[model samples]
Target: MRQAMYGLVLYVFLMLPPVANLAESVMTIHMHMQMPLFVIAGMLMTPFLKQQFPRFFAKWNSNGVPGIILFMIVVIYWMIPRTMDEALTIQAIEIFKFISLPFLAGVPLRDSWKKIRLVGKNIIFVTLSVICGFMAWLYIFSPEQLCNNYLIVEQITLGWAFLFLALSIMIYFVQQFFVDRSECE
Candidate 1:
């Protein structure tokens, strides 16, 4: 209950014009920071939502794969450069962005993460890393600006950000192979 209230507060705060404007002013902040924050707010409220609609989650996501896949699809959709532009230009798309990122992507992600096996989790992580790597290459190497709203320099910065994220994921994967769970525990 308390967590849900906190999430609601975050949701409301992020919706504020000043905050939203500042976040959206920067390309990287809009995509990487603000978007993720919305999803996180939803994740924080998952406990209450899960308790309220137990059957919906269970019936639709018995093994967690379905929910996670939905999460990935929603997230990937938002990652598209054109979608970001549409969200800024079109009011309906903006509203959908605010609503969909939280409910569509975040809720299922939190629900599915706990239920999915470790191998499943690893696969998702690796897939995201690969996607990030691809996006980085696309943004960095493209001669033209990818987003109309942002300059080429900002686009390059976002590409570097994606590169760092991909590299970090790869580093984590490498570390996992060397770490002995028995020793740590």
Candidate 2:
């Protein structure tokens, strides 16, 4: 409950005009910071939601595939450059961004993650890594501006951010490969 309250407070803080403007001012910040924070806030609310809507969640999520699909769809939509631009320019899109990122994407993601098999989890990681790499390549090398609201340099920075994310995921996998579980035991 306390955590949920904190999440709600954080969400409110992010929604403040100055804070929102600052976060949206840079492409990298908007994508990496604001977007993930929204997701985190939603994740924090998951416990309460599960408790309140156990039957509904269980019926809809079932084996978690449906919820995971919904989460992925929302994530993919937000990843598009046009969607980001529209979120900034269009009131409806902005509202949707605020609502969907948390309720639709984050909440479902938290619920699904626990239910998915190990193979399914790995698939998600690989899919995200590929997406990050592809987006990095597109943003870094494209001659044309992908988003009208941001400058070329900002796009390049976002590309680097994506590249860094991809690298981080790779590093995690490598670490997992070499970890000495036997020694720990």
Candidate 3:
């Protein structure tokens, strides 16, 4: 299970740069279609994940640590002014959806040796991939149209995405060091 998760993470990271470049070249309509397909793929994987990783689910059921942290971050950000501005707020919401990918993907591996480490690593890589993809898209397409009336939401969302990615990377490295030290001791 750990190997599989690690493989998936590597695969996603490797594929992202090319995918982003391809997305930049493709017609806007085609890109739009592809984005939702990725979402569908995630949704479809849920059942298989549950069947394969019952132990992880058990861990998730026993602990609310991840969810609680996510909630607190959201709430704290909400309290800050300008965060609620339309564009940034929408971006923040979009970022939340992106971050969900790791939690959902990692939920099935909670009790395994990799445990949260696997999740953290995968999340960090995936988030970085996404940010890179977006940067590519923004640079190439430069779509002037705002999906929402407020542009602040998009800024907030980007900020949140970076924060999540950084936090995940930090946790992953810290856990890895501890695990390595424990084994040595």
Identify the superior model by TM-score, candidate 2 or candidate 3. 2
TM-score, one value per model: 0.95, 0.94, 0.26
- Number of backbone-clashing residue pairs for each candidate, in the order shown: 0, 0, 12
Candidate 1 ranges beyond 4 A from true positions: 181-185
| Local distance difference test scores for all models | 0.92, 0.90, 0.43
* lDDT tens digits, residue span 63-139, model 3: 54453344334333432323333313465553553344333433322322233454655564555455445534443
The true-versus-predicted C-alpha distance at residue 181 of model 2, in Å, is 7.2
lDDT of 2 at 134: 92
Q: By summed lDDT, which 10 consecutive residues of candidate 3 come out lowest?
A: 27-36
Question: Which RMSD values do the candidates have, in order?
Answer: 1.4, 1.9, 16.1
Best candidate, TM-score-wise?
A: 1
Model 2's TM-score against the true structure: 0.94
Q: Point out the worst 10-residue segment of candidate 1 by lDDT.
A: 173-182
